[model samples]
Target: MGRTSDAKEKILSAAQSLIELRGYSALGVAEICKAAGVPKGSFYYFFESKEALALAVIDEHWAGQKQDWTGILNSDAQPLDRLRQLFEVTEAGQRAGQQSCGTVSGCLFGNLTLEMSNQTEAIRTRLQEIFDAQVEMVDSVITEALARDEVAVTDTREAARSVVAQLEGQVLFAKLYNNTHRLSPLWANCLALLGARVPQEALAGS
Candidate 1:
């Protein structure tokens, strides 16, 4: 049972990494099996089809992201500072990917949203829920900030969605251009959009 679970875990990790690198439509089961060091028979034993495996991948990705987001969004710092920390985390991840792959790989959820949304109903529905959940998390942070008078956002939900959309759009552009510079101004721009204080250091460095 331990080995069986390990194999499933490896397959999920490999498929997610490959999907981030190559996109969903371009990868196949054989490649996934090879990358995971699992046999085709074992893959089927765990997942009924590629679509099922993709759904698992989405679950895995969101679980990990939510864990991090919980910490960032629930911090005791000022709400805008927590939002700054989230963008810092994103820029760091993209920079690390650029250092490794010579390009920013972008967010997996956004990637799947663009690729498989129209083709797979189950995957598309799951993606929608995940993104909506993410937006709600951000909205909570925004609402709290509004309550405290730490930041000013007229419509909490809309402001949160705009921030998310801007970040995703910046990541897509950076990945498309294979350059992290495309993301340089994004953090500052997002702060401005929310009418949050543009910290001097963030404005100067970013």
Candidate 2:
């Protein structure tokens, strides 16, 4: 039982790394198994297909990300400040990934959305749900900021979607350019999208 479970985890870890470096379409089950140090049969035992494995990887990645986002977005800090921290955390995370891997890995969900969303209905639907959840989280933070008059946005939900889109787009740029610095504009851009009432310079010092 222990070894069986360990094999499954090894496969997931290996698949995520390979997918980040290359992508889903370029990989094969045998190659994934080889990287995982597991037998090809073990891949079948755990996941019925490569797509199934991909979904598992997406779920696992999002589970960790959701926790990090909840910590920052749901923090006791001022609402807009929480949003700023979220951007800061994103930049830091991308920088860390570049240092570790010599390139930006970008957001997994975003990457898969571009690479696989149209290729499979199951993958498309799952990606949509994940992104929708992200928008909802951002919407909650924006709504709080709206209540405090920290931002001038009348449509918090739409503003939140734009903010999330901006973040994802910046991350895509970071990955495409293989430079983490490309993510530096996220906070400023997010504030602009929200019609933040605070001066950008003042917010920076706060």
Candidate 3:
């Protein structure tokens, strides 16, 4: 049972990497199985279909994201500083060649929201819930910062949404341009939007 679980995790990780490099439409079950070193029989045993596997991949991605974000939020550092570190993790991922986020790989949820929302209500609803949860997490962090007087945002919810939007936009831009340069301005904008003590000149230059 443990070995079977490990195989399933390996397949999900491979699928995630492949989907990030090539959008979902370009990936195939055979490729995922090959990358994972699992047979097609095992793949079928674990996932009923490619769509099911995709959903699993999404769940795995969000699980990892939640863990990382929770750690950031619970850290002893100042809230705003913790947020900056979040961006730093993003930049580090890009630098480390994880150039795209699984959730934003062609903006998975966004793409599905447009293409499959009508056909696959379950997937669409799940995707929406995941994104909403992400936004709520950010809002909770920002709200705490406001309560502590560590930041001065006019609206914590809107500020959190803006941060999410900026990050999503950066991912889209990076994917479109095939370069991380498009993300530089977004980091600056996020800091400004959060009312962080970013230098005016630096923000302007970014």
Candidate 4:
């Protein structure tokens, strides 16, 4: 049982890497099996189909992101500091040329929504739920920041949504251009919107 579980995990990991690196539509189950060192028959033992594997990958990705974001938001640091840390984390990943992670992988949910939402109600609903949960997380963080007086904002929910939207836009632009450079202006704009001054050293091109 343990060996079987390990093999299943290996296959899932390989599938995720391929999806992130090459986009979902471009990934093939055979290639994933090869990368995972698993036989084609073994994949069926774990997942019913490639589509099921994709859904599982999406769930795993969301779970990991939720944990990371929750940890950052719940830290003892000031609210603004927490938010800044989140951005810095992403920026560091960008600097490292990590274009394959979920957020910067051009939003798996959004991609699925665009491509398969109309054809598959299950996929569409699942993606919507994921997005809704993300928004709620953002709202929680913003509300906490407001409570702590770490950031001054008139509307926490709106502010949270705005931040999420800006980040999404940055991801889209980064993916479209195949470079993180396009995100700089959006980051600066976000700082301006928040009425906060970005550290000069952290400014793009600085």
Candidate 5:
């Protein structure tokens, strides 16, 4: 039983790394099993299909990311400061990935959205739900900022969507250029989207 569970985890870990590095369309079950160092039958035993495995990978990755995002965005810091820390954390994460793998992996959901979302209804729907949740998280922060008169936005929801969009777009640019510097503009762009009322010097320290 322990070995069976280990085989399942191996498949998931390998599938995630391969998908992150090369994407979903190009991989095959045989290759995934080989990478996982498991028998091909183990892949079928754990996942009914390649798409099922992909969904599992996405869910696993989101579980980790959601925790990180929630911790940062929901922290005790000031609202705008929380947003700035979110961007800083994002940039730092990308930089760390580049250092470890010699390239930025960008956001997994964002990558899969561009690569496979349009190709499969299941993937498209799942990606939409994930993104909507992200927007909701940001909306909460913006709502708090608005209450405190820290931002000028009248439509907090829309502003939050724009901020999330900007974050994804900048991450895409970082992956495209293979340079993490592209992410440096995310905080400034987010402030512009929110029309933040905080003084520049005040935010600079964050």
Candidate 6:
């Protein structure tokens, strides 16, 4: 891409990493520019405001993740297995985050919501949309499982909501405790919610 486009991406990448590591309100334009190796003056030329940059960051992150989610969740594998695989991916991602930031930063969407929702309506609205889309993906998986008789029929959408919410809680707690291995409860809860036979280790908090 051209210099302008490349610079914009650098700014977004820098801001995304910093904000995920710290928080939106804690990191400023200068910090992002420095990390991005771009001039501070160029930030405003690319993004109208910090909120604009944050919104773009969310979009960029979600766009990159969509393909991975589609490949895993929309595959021909058993729906419940697909769901389980999603968690496996999440576990690896959490570990990677810890390695990169020296702590679990948790889901960007969840982190941004807690940090910015009460402070910025524009950002809150953007986050709500992303969150709803994620829940819809989960809902679709549960619905598929029901259609295939892979699991007992229940409110698939509600089940999706519960799974997503509980996983986010597990992520938050894992980060709070500074340990990425605190995802055992999430596995057990998710399997149980889907009517799958929960692993004994997961049941015993292993």
As for TM-score, the candidate ahead, 2 or 3, is 2
lDDT of all the models against the reference?
A: 0.87, 0.90, 0.75, 0.73, 0.90, 0.84
The segments of candidate 6 whose C-alpha lies over 4 angstroms from its true place after superposition are: 197-206
Best by TM-score: 2
What's the C-alpha lDDT at position 29 in model 5? 97
Candidate 3: pairs in clash? 104-107
User: Residue-wise lDDT of candidate 1 within 1-206, one digit each (tens)?
Assistant: 34999999999999998999999889999999999998888999999999999999999989988899889999898887788889888888889988987778999999999898999999999998988988898999889888877667889999989989988998999888887778777768767777775565655345
Candidate 3: count the clashes: 1
In model 1, pairs of residues that clash are none
Q: What is the lDDT of residue 180 in candidate 6?
A: 77
lDDT per residue for candidate 5 within 1-206, as digits (tens), equals: 34999999999999999998999999999999999999998889989999999999999998998999999989999988898899899999999989988999999999999999989999999989999989999999999999998799999889999999989998999999999999887787788788887567434224
TM-score of 1: 0.91
Question: Candidate 4's residue-wise lDDT over 1-206, tens digit each?
Answer: 34898989999889877876776677788899999998888899989988899889889988987788889878888666677777766656665645345344565566666667787666778888887887787677777766765456788777777887777778778777667666656545555545444465554444
Candidate 1 Cα outliers beyond 4 Å, as residue runs:
197-206
For the record, the alpha-carbon RMSD of candidate 4 to the native fold, in angstroms, is: 4.0
> Least lDDT summed over 10 consecutive residues: which range in candidate 2?
197-206
lDDT of 1: 0.87
Worst window of 10 by summed lDDT in candidate 5: 197-206
Point out where model 5 deviates above 4 Å: 200-206
Q: What local lDDT score does residue 155 receive in model 6, on the 0 to 100 scale?
A: 90
Query: Which is superior by lDDT, 2 or 4?
Result: 2
- How far out, in Å, is residue 18 in model 5? 0.5
**What's the lDDT of the predicted structure labeled candidate 3?**
0.75
Which pairs clash inside model 6?
A: none
